[model samples]
Target: MLDIIYKYQNLLANIDEYIEDSKFKKEYLIEQLGVSRATFYNKVKKKSFTIDEMVVLSTILFPEEAKAFEIKEALRQSREDSKAGKTRDHKDVMAEVRDKLRA
Candidate 1:
């Protein structure tokens, strides 16, 4: 619990720096967020973005990190599914992939 709290605090503290260092333009972010420039700045200054908003911003600002996280999550879920005997045969999977590629 404390670790989670600390991580959240760290994110909030460094969000402005992240924005400044991001490759994305501020205008692009504002458009994507559907917020006025003033509103976006106010939220960043106050660290008052909601959890959903933070998720969106994080996904936008750190797409590679987000993708890696998703891949890790998928791997974890696949492991759990395999343990539960939810596995598909390799040959069948490859056949499906080939069919999709041909289409």
Candidate 2:
């Protein structure tokens, strides 16, 4: 278990290095990320990625694209909230979401 976790950590670190060194290519990097081929294809077939995946990929493969996606803006907001120790009440957020959906 420890070995597997260590390997994964090393893999993630190498990915970071590749991103910084501009050596990451889509196919290669995606493979190197160590997700299963099925997962990769499913994500591709779905034509969408989770926010965390988007953040990592865009922040690496193309920061300009990330900026355009407003990831930086969202991160900035998160940072500000952290600094101020502010947090959204989940119930409030959920109620707003429900209200917006109803509208």
Candidate 3:
């Protein structure tokens, strides 16, 4: 799966275009993300996104073609995450905290 994405990095670089233009008619991406078509559509329903989601999302949506600068930045970020002892997104973090608080 990753191999296929690497092969189509150029195309993925324009994922936003593909998604917007065809309403994410691209089945490969939908499948690769392990998300249902409804999940994709749900995101489309939103009018805005958190800045962080925008960053990782751009990369996830374009693993190959995510500009050299962005790819370098993301790599540096992942390294930083490793050094920090663990890695997870803000949404995951908040969910955990919220669950603990509820408990």
Candidate 4:
């Protein structure tokens, strides 16, 4: 959806600014990511982090925003699945949930 696209674009465009403005210390972030400081700086400068690295860093630096993005992405995917008739019936879903809760 447009919201997901807009958020993705904003994240891609402002990742560097986000890193710079994060409350976490760069050294701590580097340590948490298990990357050398130089490598971290290089990646930030080049915007060349791997998807795994980006996911970890984003979760650490912007937990709320990362969660929001994930929820939006899930909703978008759910909409697509619904349009494709890939969704289970609501009664079936509720039954499954109740079964799990009982277990």
Q: TM-score of every model? A: 0.85, 0.34, 0.33, 0.57
Among residues 3 or more apart in sequence or in different chains, the pairs in candidate 2 whose N, CA or C atoms overlap within 3 Å are none
Candidate 1, residues 44-100, lDDT tens digits: the string is 899888888888899999899999999999999999999999999999999999999
> Which candidate wins on lDDT?
1
Candidate 2, poorest ten consecutive residues by summed lDDT: 11-20
Q: What digit string (tens of lDDT, one per residue) describes model 2 on residues 1-103?
A: 9997786455444544445467565566476546776776566565445556645665767657657768778989999998998988999999999999999
Q: How far does residue 95 in candidate 3 sit from its true spot (Å)?
A: 47
Question: What clash count goes with each model?
Answer: 0, 0, 0, 0
Q: Which pairs in model 3 have colliding backbones?
A: none
lDDT (CA) per prediction: 0.92, 0.66, 0.61, 0.86
Ranking by TM-score: 1, 4, 2, 3
Residue-level lDDT of model 3, residues 18-39, one tens digit each, is 4666433446545655567777
Write down the worst ten-residue block by lDDT for model 3: 47-56
lDDT of 3: 0.61
For model 1 the local lDDT of residue 41 reads: 94
TM-score of predicted model 1?
A: 0.85
On a 0 to 100 scale, what is the lDDT of residue 93 in model 3?
Answer: 91
Tell me the alpha-carbon RMSD of every candidate. 1.6, 14.2, 12.9, 4.7
